[model samples]
Target: MTTIHNGVSPRAHAVQAAAALAASMGIGRFVYTPILPLMHTQSGLSASLGATLATANYVGYLIGALAGILIPGVVRSAAVMRTSLVVLIATLALMPTTHDGSIWFALRLVAGIASALVFMIAVSALHAHLRGQSQFLAGWGFGGVGLGIALSGVLVFVVRFIGSWGTAWLASASLAVVCAVAAWGLTPEPRPIITPDAPGTPSSHRWFTALVISYFLEGIGYIIAGTFLVAAIDLAALQWVGSGAWIVVGLAAFPSCALWAWLSLRWSRPTLLLVALLIQAVGIALPAVIGGVGPALISAFLFGVTFLGIGSIALAIGAHLQFPRAVALLTAGYSVGQILGPLVVTPLLRDGYRDALLLGAAVVLGAAVAAAVLRFRFPSDLDADPRTATSTEEVVFDVR
Candidate 1:
C-alpha cells in the first residue's frame, strides 16, 4: 500500500530525504556568511558590493519563489532540482571572478533564483509526503541546516589553507552533487488523483495574511543577524570568536527546532513565535551595541535557538487561518523581505552595521506586533487545532 516516493513507513525515509535537501539549501545561505571577515582583505570585496551580492541572491530568491508558486511544473519535477543544483554550483564557482560589480550582482541574482526554486520544491515535497509525521521529525529534517552550516563553515576554514575561495566553491559543489544524487530518488512526481476539501471547510485567510506579514518581517529581521552578525563580530575585533560563534549557532539549531515545536503542543504557537522574535531581536541588538566576547556568544546562542522552525510555524499559522493560498503568499512575501534585508543594510555598514542591527530589531519587533495582532484579531481560532500537518491532512501549506 505504501511507496518509497510517497513515504514508505516510519517516516524515516522522508526525514532523510528532507534532511538532504535542507542541507543542500542551507549550505548556500551560510557559505558567504562566515567569510565576511575575509571579504574585503582577501577577496577585494567592499561593503556596498557585498551588500549588492546579498541583494542579488535574495532578489533571485524572490523571483524564483514566485515562479515556483505560480507555476506548478516548477515544483513537481526532478529535472527542475537537477537544473537548480547545477546553477547553484556554477554561480558559486563564479564568485572569485566577480571583479566587476555588475557581473557579480547578476550572477548572484541567478544563484538566488536557483536556490529559491530548489528550496521551495524540496520543502514542498517533504511536507507533502511527510504528513502525519511528528513535528520533531520535521524539525529534525530541518536541522540539516545546522549540518550544512557546519560543513560549509569547515570548508571555508579549510579554504584558508589554500587561500582560494574558488576552491571552496568547487569542493562545496562536489558535495552538493553527491547529496543531489542521493536526494533524486526521494523526489516526487504528481499522482493522478486529487482530493477535495470536505463539507464546511474552515476559512483561515485572515490568519494566513497575518502569518505572511510576520514571516516577511522575520525574513528582514533574521537576515540582519544571520548575514551580518559575522561582520559585526569581526568589526569588534573578535574574529576567532565570531567565526566559532557561528558553529555554536549551527550546533544549537539542530535540536532546538524539534524541542520548540514539541513545546508548541502545550503552549500557544503565536506566543512561542513572539518569544522567538524577542530572542532573535535581543541577539541582533546585543552584539550591535556590546563589545565583549561573552555578549557575542550569548547573541549567537539565542539566535541559533530561535532561528529554526520559523517556516513551519508560519505554515502552521496559515493552516489555522484556513487560507487556501497562505503558503504561496507567505513564501513570496518572505522572499521579498529576504531580498530587502541585505539591500537595506548595505548603506548602514558604513555606520559599523549597528544601523542594520537596529533595523533588524525593528523588523523582528514588527513580527511580534503582527503576531499580537493575529492573536487579538483571531481569538476564536486559537483554541482550535491549527497545526493540520498530519499525514491524514492535505499538504496544502507546502505551496512554497
Candidate 2:
C-alpha cells in the first residue's frame, strides 16, 4: 500500500516498467512478419494454420484487454507487473515450440492476456506519477512500444541471419529476463485512479463506441497490409525491394511515434489521427492497386509514417475525453478493434488482396471520419488518465 498520489514520484521507475512491458508484448512480431514465408517453406505450416496462430494471439489480446477493464489495479503494482511479464516471457519462449496448431493458439491467447495486464497496469503507474509532469509523460510511456518494436526487429534480423527460430525466441526471452530484473525493484507505488467503464458513462461511452469502431477497423485495414505487404512485394517479383521496404517502415516508425506525440503538443489529437489514418489507408491499398517497386516502396514508407502515430493518437484522444473511465474504455475499444481486424480479413485472404485492401481502406476511412467527429465534438483533455492502448491494437507494423 505505498501511495504515490501526493509524494515522491517514480517517473524513472514508471518508464522502466513501460519499456519492459512493451518489449514483452512485442515478442516475435517482427520475426513473424518477414520470416513467415520462410517458416511456411521450411517448417511445413499451412497458410491457414499460420493465420490461425495469428488469430489466436489477437484473440488472446482481445480477451486480455477486456479483463483489464474490470481488473482492480494500482500504479507501481510490482506483483501485477511481474506476474504479467512472466506470463509474456514464458509465452514468447514457448510459442515456437508448440507444433500443434490448437495448442499454439491457446498459448498465444494466454500471452495476449498477460501482455494486456502488464501494458495497462504499467500505464496506470506512469499516469499516476506523471500527474504533475507535463502531458507528454504518458506519451513517452506509449512511445516505449515503438522502441520495443525497433528492438524486436533487430532481434528478428539477427535470428534470421543465424537461421533458427529457436534462437530468436531465446534471445527475446533473455531480453525479457533482463527487463524483469530491472522492473522488479521499481517503487511499488499505486496511483489509485479509477479508469473508465465499458458500458457506463453515456457521453464518454458513446464516443468510446465510435473510437472502438475506428480502432477495430484500423485493425482490419492495417493487418491486411501488414500480413501480406511482404508477400505482395514478392508476388510482384521484387523480393529485395520488399525486404528493404519493411526495414524502411521500421526505421521510420521508431522516430515517427515520438514525432507524432510531439505533434499532439501543437495540434488536435483527432486531426493528426485522421490524417495518419487516411495516409495509411492509401498506403495499404497502394501495393495491390499500383504496380512496380516505386509505388510499392512508397506505399511502405507512407504506411510506416502514418501507422506509428495511430496508437498514440487514439490513446491521446482517450485522454482528452475526460470521463473517469476513459482510459479503460479506450483500451477495450481498441482491443475489440484488434480482434475483429484479423477475423474479418481472414476469410478474404484467398480473394487476392483486392478485397483485403478495399476492406482496409474502407475501415480506415471510417476511422478518419470518427476521428473528425471526436475532434470537433469533444476536443479537450477530459480523460487525461494514464494508460497504454498502444498494444490495445498493433502499435507499429512493418511489411508482413
Per-residue lDDT of 285-384 in model 1, one digit per residue for the tens?
Answer: 8887888799888888888888776666666666555454555566667778887898878878886777898789889989988877666546444333
**TM-score for each model:** 0.87, 0.80
Q: Return the clash pairs for model 1, or none.
A: 131-391, 132-390, 132-391, 204-321, 204-322
The models' CA-based lDDT, in order, is 0.69, 0.62
The Cα error of candidate 1 at residue 98, in Å, is 4.1
**lDDT for 148 (candidate 1):** 70
Off by over 4 Å in 1: 1-12, 192-209, 377-400
Clashes of each: 5, 7
